[model samples]
Target chain A: MAGHKIDGTAIAKSIRERIHAQIKEAQKLNPRYKPCLKIVQIGERPDSSTYVRMKLKAAEEAGILCELVHLPSSITESELLLQIQNLNNDHSVHGILVQLPVPNHISEHTVTSAVAEEKDVDGFGTMNIGELAKRSGKPLFVPCTPKGVMVLLKESGVDLRGKNAVVLGRSDIVGSPVSYLLKNADATVTVCHSHTQNLSDFVRRADVVVAAIGKPGFVKGEWLKEGAVVIDVGTNYIPDTSKKSGQRLVGDVDFDSAIEVASQITPVPGGVGPMTVAMLLQNVVDATTAYFDKQKARHVVPLPLKQLSPVPSDIAISRCQHPKLITQAAGETGIAAHELVPFGRVSN
Target chain B: MAGHKIDGTAIAKSIRERIHAQIKEAQKLNPRYKPCLKIVQIGERPDSSTYVRMKLKAAEEAGILCELVHLPSSITESELLLQIQNLNNDHSVHGILVQLPVPNHISEHTVTSAVAEEKDVDGFGTMNIGELAKRSGKPLFVPCTPKGVMVLLKESGVDLRGKNAVVLGRSDIVGSPVSYLLKNADATVTVCHSHTQNLSDFVRRADVVVAAIGKPGFVKGEWLKEGAVVIDVGTNYIPDTSKKSGQRLVGDVDFDSAIEVASQITPVPGGVGPMTVAMLLQNVVDATTAYFDKQKARHVVPLPLKQLSPVPSDIAISRCQHPKLITQAAGETGIAAHELVPFGRVSN
Candidate 1:
């Protein structure tokens, strides 16, 4: 039986529509409210330009104000960092992203780290990645590609809880973060890389397979378990004499063979690729909402401090101050009562 | 047939001896060179005091200047933070650890994070834990329990490369970090926790099993694959009227049954307990050595900066400067030739 194909393009379109509606609602509340995204491209690399253009178009469609700042190849690392700093300081810009494969002179690590944690929509910075890796960490934004993969998994109606998930890469951008997401979702995730031995044995037992190794057809269909769900994150281009570009995009899975055995699969080019831009748009919207929420919260009146003679100890002062119930406080901050998990009476 | 005992107590002793000899050598060079550890204990919990006492004794035995600061339970978080700041600023203290189980009024997260990263020998802070989680991160110190577990595995001669390792529990201290360590060592790791369904299924295929779920005898021998290496990090206590304390320590795995099925295993009480204190002393020594190394490096002559007439761009200025070969630079920093992995000409 042929497997069902996960329609990422259609799913991304629906998500973009939701974002557009959300942006419209926000604008209705305050005409000045606009989610803004700034993309920094260091060089004129054709691939980088294409990706940036795609992001710009998607953001525009989603009612996000997307701006591209194209810097020359001769720009210095310090100059690039200065540009990022200016964007970081701008209150209008909610999301800032530095396109990858920056000039050799500019250390990618330094450039990515330069993005403010609040505005790091790409989620490549140490703080974001670190939070994603942590079990109890709350990352402001997850990297787009991994976030997109998770969306596909969710849309496909696959219950990750207690399932066996085998991630086929360990890259910081895709494999590592995705593994953490799966584990957090309660999947028994096993990360397999080049160093992994008997890779087929792992694939054969996996209930869900996410291949991001970037190799063309690295995972064979015969190696997959029957009725397994496959999410292919690879975007490798192999030579295709019939194609006008002389190459065709293929995923890490042997698609034709995998389609026959897998219960659900995501096709190359139209799968994980489209969802990335959609997720980026979503992250910008989320950041913009948070910014406004913080602004609203800033208006809250501060409690009058009652000073005691000789100044009591810090704990004594705190204990004397009556605090709002945690549930009430959470509600005031837009958190639903169901969303609050009380650990103890400290907040009571 | 019974499996061989891991003998963690003996291994830890040998490690302590190594640390002692190294400290003696450092002191011989300069009598002022002494590793110092400061452990802050809040409240008078019997278990906390016992653990702190054990650490103090072990650190002293390993030639480290160990100091315990006992604070009242009523002390506020700010006061405790102030004390930690003092230790952080103290040049004589190489390692600073805050004993766990602080009063409910004090946020453990805040207290742990307040410890300076360089002096956070406990490795519970966000920076250290985040670094530990990253793929290419260089954490200053791994948490003592997880570090000890790795040392046990190494001493037992188990090569983790491409091995199937199952880690039980997902606690940040032991389970999470140990899984990262195992994955970094090239093991295909599956982390199972309370929500995990059919946990036995994951364990039954493991080549190496690390149980830290804190439930006594949670993992049975039948759940483990024959000849698997087991490292139990649990220290659960159950009623034993026959003993004076009316309790006995047991591991997450049923020791008696596990020994019959496993190739090597760490017993309860004498196993992981001693190693924790040993690793703590080792971290202090390591920090002390790094401190002195930094001091020695500070004495190096600085390169004279050349100011050009036209005021060149940052990239141009950097490009004009000649950099020492990475091998030579690494050597100067005490990194051996074999330890350096050349990525590209950027370092040349």
Candidate 2:
């Protein structure tokens, strides 16, 4: 039997629609409201430029205003930081994303941290990374790729709880955060890297496998368990003389063989890549909503939600049960009540 | 053949001896040099009190100064925070540890983050946690239990490279950090928690198993691979009529059966418990050294190492290989030359 193809384009389109609807509703609540994202790119490479264009197009499609700031390679780190600081203070800019691999002279950490947590749409800030690691409260922003992988798993109807999931990589942007997210979603996650001995042994036992090792076809079909759900995040370029470009993209897993072993699998080129851009737009919408929510709570801005969609009744019931406890706690801390969103119920 | 028992007491004693030697050397360099730790405790739970006393005793025996600041259970969060801020400013306090489970009225995040990163001996600060998660630089402080586990593994001569290491917990302080640590040390790590469906299957395939799940005997011996190394971090008290106190401490692993299959194992109470305190003392020494190193670089303090132990020859060789590039970069960043410690020779 052929494995089910986990279509990223379809899922990404659905997410974009949801974001579009949300943004439309949010705008109805306030006419001046428009989700916005600022992309700060320094000395862009071909790959970086392609990604930025894709993201900007996706954001516009999702009812988000996108601005791209291009800086020269000779720009000093301080100058780049100043630009980010300006974007951070500009309340009109709801999300800020600094494309990776800025000039070597610039410290990535210094630039990444300069984006305010409210506008850190990439979710690379130390505090956001810390929050993700801690698995406490709602993470301000889940890194796009990992967050997209999660949406795929969720939409696929894969039950992660109690599943033995193996993540093949430990990259800061993808593998590590994805493992943490899977664990938080109730999957038992094993992270295998180059140093992992007998990597096939772990793969053979996993119910779900995510390959982000960057090597082309590093994970073999025989190593995967039959009926495993596979999410391949690797996008590697390899020689393909048959093609006009003399090169093609492949994932860490041998898709042709893995499809035979995996009950479900995501295809390269169309998988994981599109979901990342969709999540970026979603983050902009989220950041915009949060900004307005905080302002409304402070009584500094009027936000009447009469024309917007009402919250689902089931959620309304559950939230009503808590009454004033959450608000009271937030008040005591001098934080606006709307910002203290609680995670499910407190565990004993 | 009986499995070798890892003795925690002996290891702790040896560590204390090294600490004593280091303190003597530090004093020789600067007579007024003193490693000091300030532990703030609130509402003295019996368990918390016991741990605080043990840490204090260990610190005292290691030739370090210790102080306990007790606050009433009813203390407001702000008041507790104020106390922490005061400790943060005390130049003489090299390390600060706020015991966990401070009154519910106070947010743990508030108390934990209140301690400055330099003085956060518990290693719970977001920046420190982020550093540990990224495995980029030397963490300011490794959480006591996880750090102890690393030391135990090293002392046992376990080659972590390419090892199948399964961490049987996902607690922030232990399992998560330990998994990151093991990954950094070149081990393929699987983190299992309450949500894991087939925990036994994962454990049985491990070369090294770290059980920190807190459940008494949650890990069965039959689940361990033969010759696997086991490090149990659980300290659970279960009712036992045979004991005079009507209860006995146990670990997450069934040690009696584990010893039969494992090549090495640590016993409950006699194992991980002592190492936590030992590592705490080690962190204090580290914090103290960094404090003085900074002051000495500022020319605000006189610290000469004429009578102190010379740097280890192997480390010295590694340090000399970096031909001043790191120091130059650090200098450009406004850091003093003396404070620019290099980590081997990897540079642009």
Q: Give one digit per residue, the lDDT tens place, for model 1 in A1-348.
A: 999999999999999999999999989999988999999998799989989999999988888999999999987765676678678867788999999988888888778878988889998887787677778777889999999999999999999998989999988789988988999998988889988889999899999999999999999999999999999999998999999999999999999999999999999979999999999999999999987886677332244476789999999999876565454456467543224454433111
In model 2 chain B, which range of ten residues has the least summed lDDT?
Answer: B299-308
Question: What are the candidates' individual DockQ scores?
Answer: 0.21, 0.21
TM-score of chain A, model number 1: 0.87
Q: B58 in model 2: Cα distance from truth in Å?
A: 1.4
Question: What is the TM-score (0 to 1) of candidate 2?
Answer: 0.83
> Could you tell me the lDDT of residue A268 within candidate 2?
93
lDDT of 2 by residue, A1-348 (tens): 668989999999998999899888877889978888999999959999989999888988888999899999988775676577668757688899999978889888778878898889999887787778775534689999999999999989999999989999998889988988998888889998988777898899899999998999988889989999999999999999999999999989899888988899999988898899998888888899888776666432121122325655766645544233333345444464223444332111
Cα DockQ of the candidate 1 complex = 0.21
- Write down the lDDT of every candidate, Cα atoms only: 0.86, 0.83
In candidate 1, what are the lDDT values of residues B239-260, reduced to their tens digit? 9999999999889989899999
Which CAPRI tier for candidate 2? incorrect
Clashing pairs in 1: none
